[model samples]
Target chain A: MLKAFASYMTYEFIGLDQGSRIGDVLNFFIYDTIKIFLLLTVIIHAVSIIRSYFPPEKTRKILAHKREFIGNILAALLGVVTPFCSCSAVPLFIGFVEAGVPLGVTFSFLISSPMVNEVAVVLLWGLFGWKIAAIYMVTGLLVAVLAGFVIGKLKLEKWVEEYVYQIKTGQGQQVLTQTFRQRLQYARWNTADILKRIWLYVVLAIGLGGFIHGYVPQDFLVRYAGNGNPFAVPMAVALGVPLYSNAAGVIPIVYALMEKGLNTGTVLAFMMAVTALSLPEMIILRKVLKIPLLIVFAGIMTVTITAVGYLFNAIL
Target chain B: MEIKVLGPGCANCHTMEQLAKTAVAALGIEARVEKISDIQEIMKYTMSTPGLVVNGKLKHAGKPLPSIEKVKAMIKEEA
Candidate 1:
């Protein structure tokens, strides 16, 4: 009797009982919140702690001191370790411009930072094999580096707000002093705050993912977006422009979509669209960059992500 | 120890913060963590909140939590 009662309670808490018609939706929302919470509290915190050592202001100085090509390369490398999120895009943009980093190089860093990260890499490795993950990383890095180089040659300096030109470079490094115990506390609190902010986005993304996971028609996707579909790659690229979110948020969806028969190229295109040209990130960028620069950036990203996606689909 | 996570409480920042705590707990370290939601305060640290500072030194920000061993090493080195 006791064991049976406990099992019943568990179902009730998870809302898995047969009588609960809302169980699926509620369960999904709860699952997402917890997943986002765990991700925020643990994965993101560790990354930030490491990031504290390599401040953006310092990165700008280092890159500025190097050759243009080297600067672009180093910037992409630094992007992997730095703490650039959707929210910080505008300020970082200002900081980069003020520090005299070329616009194209900065764009490369900006594009890569969100589209690829350790978390996404690890998650992708777990979901797919290492081959796909490796392909994703290499292709993503290439897109960012090449796009930035191309844009750099075009000289879109006029697109920047005049105020950005006046911003100073090399702000003094800010360091926090704390014992091991204290750093832990800082991490915990940040987790709570971050989870609160993006939990909804995570849930919505995951919920759509779950539905696709449970019920998307695979044959249709294969017929339309499979390796053989010539038009699928371009179509996927165009579609990525309007949808927005970072790589972290989109990778899971990619996994779910792939499980439902989505092709690698199509998934890659979606991931790029959502990562590099996120609507939310762009909206945030609007505060600093003009429409022309934003359009150009978006257009370039769309073409590159599409091409890469198709190329990977063909090769891998 | 003074720790500051800069952001308006986005998911990534939150995860980084949480993982920091988990690392601390697993390692048996006790500490105080502060969350900075205000844009002005965060701007004081390169406009990056969800940022981590150990002993008045900015150590990490922007990405998710790293491996526990690495974080433990960083804390010990700082000490």
Candidate 2:
């Protein structure tokens, strides 16, 4: 009787050990969340400081003289460095228009600013490595330039608010009075402010990501998102539209989804969609643009990026 | 050193103020922290807020106050 009881006890202990080990593996995801959040915070703050030195007014002048194809290239390059957020869009737009920057060139800057922010670049690099980061940067720039050229050709000048054109043309050349020291001070403050607003979003998204990292049923996500699924890319893009998050906040989730066996193309499409088509940004845009223009902009971005995402996944 | 939390008195702004106080206390720093709620005044230094100004230099903006270590580093760098 004693020998039988001993054997039973050993079996139960082994089972519990295996279960607890799995639990430990799951718990590691929490640490990953913390690490990612802290890293992103630092990177974003650094970018914010850089953006402070080059005010939007300065960018306006650069785009003005270089209008057309060259201007589009310059604007895309600037877009890679500038860290403008959704709120800055209208003011920047007005500034560019006031400076007589060609519509397509200015549009390129606007599209690139929010879609490929510094924080997104840093986060993508951290999550996926330099190759994916480079791909995103190149692909993102192409979309902005192409979209701007197309819209410019369409002659969307009538869409501009009259007040925007009347608001003192060439305000870009006005010398900012703030001292170098003061500018640095402003940059630091902006960095912290942006970080505070988005930190919660980052944490919430990462927490969801952590949970996904731990226990997403891989077979299910894969069956839908995986290879040769004709609808997968568009479906992913559509799914991403309503959701709003900065790239810094979404890349971790993307990584988690990928780990769960989601296709790279689908994940990329989702990332671009969420960043570019945020509902909050759309609501904000409504204050500035007519509904038709807003829909067209969003629709173009969604279709273009979905195609890019699929192409990337198939190629690499 | 004087620390100011600049914002439009939103919920997040208030939370930032409290967090700044807590972080300052945690570090046992001898500093006066004030919340600047006026939009006009906040715009004087930054278009983005809640801005964190330590010793008249903006330490952070568009984000909450950082952890205790960051605060201490700012103090050290400024000092």
Task: Tell me the docking grade of candidate 1.
Answer: incorrect
Quote each prediction's TM-score.
0.66, 0.69
lDDT (10s digit) by residue, model 2, range A177-278: 467675566556666776666667566655565566556676757776677577888888888888887776676668777767777767877888887777
Return the lDDT, model 1, position B55. Answer: 58
State the lDDT at B13 in candidate 1: 70
Best by TM-score: 2
In the range B1-79, model 2's lDDT, one tens digit per residue, is 7888777555656776877787778777788889986533554455445567777777755433455566567655665
- The per-residue C-alpha lDDT of model 1 at residue A87 equals 71
lDDT of candidate 1 over A68-140, digit per residue (tens): 6667777787888775667777667776776677888888888888877766665556456577778777888
Best by DockQ: 1
In candidate 2 the C-alpha lDDT for residue A236 amounts to 85
For candidate 2, what is the DockQ-based docking class?
Answer: incorrect
Q: After superposition, how far is residue A230 of candidate 1 from its true place, in Å?
A: 0.4
